[model samples]
Target: MTVKKGLKDAYSLKTPMDSVNLYRAWASTYDNDFAIKNDYRSPSEVVKYYSKYSKKTDTPILDVGAGTGLIGECLREQNSRKIDAIDISSEMLNLAKSKQVYSKFIEADLTKKLNIASSQYGAVLSSGTFTHGHVGPEVFDELVRILKPGGLFIVTIHTGVFHNQGFKQKLSQLGKCISPPVFHKVNAYGSKIDKKHGNDKVIITVFRKKMS
Candidate 1:
């Protein structure tokens, strides 16, 4: 797919390849154009939940779909160290690396086996990653695999993905591996400057890996 030039066009992308192309094109101004412009709040909300439950600030935390490191930046504000980032777009990852917030970064698709070892992170945070045509419930097992036993993970999923894509069923299938999931409503559009920016529906799920 030819990369779209506008935020509206980016949202219309329907495939992972389309996502890759779009992010590559948007990397330079992603934060300003998308997160800030749309009043994106998933990163800060995910971090708020993660910090409340997580005791250590220096332990490794993986930021899936870390994008231009928006979540990493927010994580740092909470005094979090040892943050690692992974995104499918090298362009985005490179921009993230430039911020010096994440300890490391890897380019990989969420729907496949990651290059890192299992049980490597103390916690994981993701936002704006699971949505239309990006990734689906298939990534759950690998997410569980990478998190240490008892590791906490907070992620936001598009409301459509959560309801229409059998995310609840996938949670049921992994009952043996994770704690019961907790759902939090996320303002899909929380622009402080835009009074009418809260119509989109999304949910943030927080859960923990279980010890074998």
Candidate 2:
């Protein structure tokens, strides 16, 4: 799928391939155009919150949908633990590699082939992924599968009326099955800038995998 040349390419997700292509095309200016405007504080805030409950261990962190290495860079600054970032777009991963924030970068599709093993990561962090509207239950299941017992999964979601019903219920069910993971509402006032794209309310949800 080739990326469209304008703003429509940025907000619309016609297919999973389109999302990958769009990010690949937008990688050069992704931070300048979107990251700063929408989620400037997301990476830092995620690091801060995760640090409060857990210490940085030698175990690696898996950053899903890790575009441009923003989250990996934030994690690196917090401590020197290994960080592996994965994205579907080689262009995006290339941009992320240029930042020199992650220890490893892999190109893979979360919904199709994760390529990461179960109980391998100490934490799994993602930002700006769920909000993109492409992720579904399959991605969620893969995320849960990759986490070690007691590992952390942090993510942000575009809030809407739909969050109160269908999506919320699915997440609740996921939490129950995935080592009893618990969701915490993260306030957006400190981490995100209010923007008018859609009527979606963005919220961060942190889940802790239960210890085996």
The candidate that wins on lDDT is: 1
Score residue 175 of candidate 1 by CA lDDT: 92
Q: Which ten residues in a row have the lowest lDDT in candidate 1?
A: 1-10
lDDT of 1 at 76: 79
| Alpha carbon lDDT of each predicted model | 0.82, 0.69
Error of 1 at 115 (Å): 1.6
Query: Which pairs clash (backbone N, Cα, C closer than 3 Å) in model 1?
Result: none
State, as a TM-score between 0 and 1, how close model 2 is to the true structure: 0.81
How many clashes show up per model? 0, 1
Tens digits of lDDT, candidate 2, 20-41: 8777678887777666655566
Q: List the residue pairs that clash in candidate 2.
A: 159-201
The candidate 2 region of ten consecutive residues with least summed lDDT is 190-199
Stretches off by above 4 angstroms in model 2 are 1-8, 37-39, 161-165, 179-200
